[model samples]
Target chain A: DTAVSQTPKYLVTQMGNDKSIKCEQNLGHDTMYWYKQDSKKFLKIMFSYNNKELIINETVPNRFSPKSPDKAHLNLHINSLELGDSAVYFCASSQDTDGGTEAFFGQGTRLTVV
Target chain B: SQELEQSPQSLIVQEGKNLTINCTSSKTLYGLYWYKQKYGEGLIFLMMLQKGGEEKSHEKITAKLDEKKQQSSLHITASQPSHAGIYLCGADSSNAGKSTFGDGTTLTVKP
Candidate 1:
């Protein structure tokens, strides 16, 4: 079974089009996250949700919004996508323990805004 | 605000050779993780180190967290083409369940 899965492994859309990427995890994790990997392979955290509650919000543009319908699903919606928003988006989930946390990542959705 | 910096952005090694990739952090690391990603794929968790001076080995890959907990290294022995991939280092300073990742080091093993 795939631990973490995301829809639309590849997305190519118009510059002004709005798009959404859906993610789900079956690991029964309490925390989930959205990360963006730019062309330089810099993976930066954009948002984090713990049990459907927003916990961490990086300084991402307002056009990007994350919605967690439940603990198992977290989706990202981008409005009026710009060229700068073209990057690979990854969804990850982790369970926190006193010892440490190990994250499981989805296959990633490659978004290209032209 | 780059918190983690991985050295040797990319490397090329011959089969049966050994190589090492280093990750340096500007602040203390409460937990450090090593992950590998193939082209256009998700990250695969390799190992996690919390205690300073900790070392873990998996197959021919070994990861070590320095005594200061501010640096870590991933070493591969008897490199093979199948081992080529991007290795990323993630650090959590507060153990807040969120991690800060480095740009990643790309390794290419040639036959």
Candidate 2:
């Protein structure tokens, strides 16, 4: 069984379009996060939710929003997709408690904006 | 800002050789985690170090946390092509559940 899964694995959209990537974790983890990996391989956190509560919101743009309907699902929605937003997006989950924060990442969604 | 810097951005080694990668944190770390990511895939958790002077090994990979807890190292023994991937080090600076990841070290093992 997949511990953490995100879809669609690849995304190609045009500028000014809106898109959403869905993520789910079956590990029963309490914390879920969205990360963006640029071409330089820099993985930066964009948002984090714990038990459906927003915990950490990094310096991501307002056009990007993350929603967690429950503890097992966290989805990322991007509006007015720009070419600069072309990068791989990853979803991750963890236990949230101190010393239990080992994250399990999803197989990333490669977003291409044209 | 909290940052984790990994040295030797990329390395290539023979199948039987050994190599080491280092991660330095700009701020004190509450915990350090090591992960490996294959090309076009998600990251796989390797190990987590919480205390200073802690060392753990799994298979041919060993990770150590420095005495000051600001530095960490990952060493691989008898490298194999199967070990070729990107190794990343993540640090939790505040113990608040947010981890900052390094840029990652790309390793290529030749058969």
Candidate 3:
């Protein structure tokens, strides 16, 4: 079974169009995260939720909002997307909030804004 | 804020040749992770190191953490085309599971 999965493996949209990406993890983890990988392949943490509680919120713009309905799901919604929003979004999950554990990542969603 | 810097942004090596990638951190790391990412795919966890001066090997890849906990290195022996991908090092300094990653090193293995 796929431990982590994200829907819409690829997405292409125009500027000002809003879109959402869904992520789910079946590893029975207590922490989930959202990351953004730019054209340079630099991965940055955007948000993290532990047991449905927001634990880490980087300096990401308000346009990017992450919602975790429960411990197993974390979804990202972008509002009024801009051209700069083009990047690959990844979903990850770990056993807990500890940094010593390895994180399982889902196949990323490639989002392109024109 | 913690930052990880990976050296040799990209590498090209012939098949059977060995290569090493280094990751340095700005502060003491509580945990370090090594991951590989194939083109157009997600990051795959390779190994994790928590203690200083510790080394772990999987298959042909081995990772080591420095005694200062401020640096780590990943070495691959007899690399093959199937090993080509971006190698990323992540550091957790705050123990919050918020890993900070370095710009990956792109490895290209020639046949």
Candidate 4:
């Protein structure tokens, strides 16, 4: 079984359009995270949810919002996407909030805003 | 906040050759992880090191954490074209499962 999976593996939208990426993990983890990898290949944390509760929220734009319906699903919604929003988005899950535990990542979703 | 810096932004090695990639952190690390990412794909966890001076090996890849827990190195022996990918190092200083990742080191293995 795929441990973690993200839908719409590839997204190409025009500027000002809104889109959402869905992530689901069957690892039965409590902590989940959303990360953005820019063109430079710099992976930056965007948000984290533990058991459906927001734990970490980076300085991302207001247009970007993360909704965790439950511990197994975390979705990212971006409004009025800009060119800068073109990047690969990854969803990850861990057993707990302990850094000692290894994280399982999904096959990232590549977003392109033109 | 913590920052990870990786040296030799890119590397190219011939098949069967050996190479090493280094990751340095700004603060002491509580957990260090090594991951590999093929183009347009997610990261695959390779190994994790916690204790200072800790070392772990998987197949031909070995990773080590420095005594100070502020740096780590990943060495690959007998490289193969299949081993080519982007290697990333992530550091966790807060033990919160939130990792700070380095830019990444792109490796290209030639036959």
Residues A7-112, model 3: lDDT tens digits: 9899999999989999999999999999999998899999999999999999999999999999999999999999999999999999998779899999999999
DockQ for every model comes to 0.69, 0.70, 0.86, 0.83
Q: Give residue B73's lDDT in candidate 2 (0 to 100).
A: 98
Q: Write the per-residue lDDT of candidate 2 for residues B54-76, one digit (tens) a residue.
A: 99999999999999999999999
- lDDT by residue for model 1 (A1-114), tens: 999999999999999999999999999998899999999999999999988999889999999999999999999999999999999999999985332689999999999999
**Candidate 2 second chain TM:** 0.97
lDDT of 2: 0.93
Please report, as a residue range, the 10-residue window in candidate 1 chain A with the lowest summed lDDT.
A94-103
The Cα RMSD across the true interface for model 2 is 1.6
**How high a TM-score does candidate 1 get?**
0.98
Residues B1-111, candidate 3, lDDT per residue (tens digit)?
Answer: 439999889999999999999999979999999999998889999999999999999999999999999999999999999999999999899657889899999999999
Give me the runs in candidate 2 sitting further than 4 Å from their true place. Answer: A97-100
lDDT of each: 0.94, 0.93, 0.94, 0.94
lDDT of 4 by residue, A1-114 (tens): 999999999999999999999999998999999999989899999999999999999999999999999999999999999999999999999998887889999999999998
Residue B94's lDDT within candidate 4 is: 62
**Model 2, span A11-113: residue lDDT tens:** 9999999999999999999999999999989999899998999988989999999999989999999999999999999999998745436899999999999
- Model 4 stretches astray by more than 4 angstroms: none
Model 3 spans with C-alpha error above 4 angstroms: none
Q: Could you tell me the lDDT of residue B25 within candidate 4?
A: 88
**iRMSD, all candidates:** 2.0, 1.6, 1.0, 1.1
Candidate 4: residue pairs that collide: none
lDDT tens digits by residue: candidate 1, B1-111? 889999889999999999999999989999999999999899999999999999999999999999999999999999999999999999898657668899999999999
Q: Residue B45 in candidate 4 has what lDDT? A: 99
